[model samples]
Target: MKGQENKEEKMECKKEENLVSCLCTYYSCSRKGVCCDCIRYHLKSRQLPGCCFSRDAEATYDRSFEHFARLVQEGKV
Candidate 1:
């Protein structure tokens, strides 16, 4: 069906646009501009995307939920 064909076509990601605000400090990472891929990769590793952390925290590369919780408790996030 025409509608099905439209739905089946993958939509283009705004990688360039997303990159403008992407704060992840890992310059060599493949998922730098692709938010969904970054999220999936981190989730699989039991971690979170770097942008979920503050700039300083993100730099520490501690993307664990426990670390985020500590920041939350400290009101530093």
Candidate 2:
């Protein structure tokens, strides 16, 4: 039905958006595992990982944990 087709199209668009939003990538790392590793590295540095941020914020490299905490405090998360 037309409604079912529209729902599938929307899901596809969301999947593409998620892929486009991904920021951290290492050729040597498995794609599925890279996110976990990247998050750990950022956390150890007192920062939030790229995936934690919106596209614009991630582009700023403002991955500071303090920034993340502040966003959370402000209910921006």
Best by TM-score: 1
Q: Give the total clashing residue pairs for model 2.
A: 0
Rate residue 17 of model 2 by lDDT. 51
Model 2 residue 41 CA deviation (Å) reads 1.3
State each model's C-alpha RMSD to the native.
2.5, 8.9
The global Cα lDDT (0 to 1) of model 1 is 0.89
lDDT of 1 at 76: 92
Model 1, span 30-69: residue lDDT tens: 9998998999999998888988888999999999989989
- TM values, all candidates: 0.84, 0.53
Q: In candidate 1, which residue pairs clash?
A: none
For residues 1-77, could you state the per-residue lDDT of candidate 2 as single tens digits? 65465343322224335556576443343442345556677778888777787666666778898877887898777
Q: Residue 39 of candidate 2: its Cα lDDT?
A: 68
Clashes of 1: 0
Pairs that clash in candidate 2: none
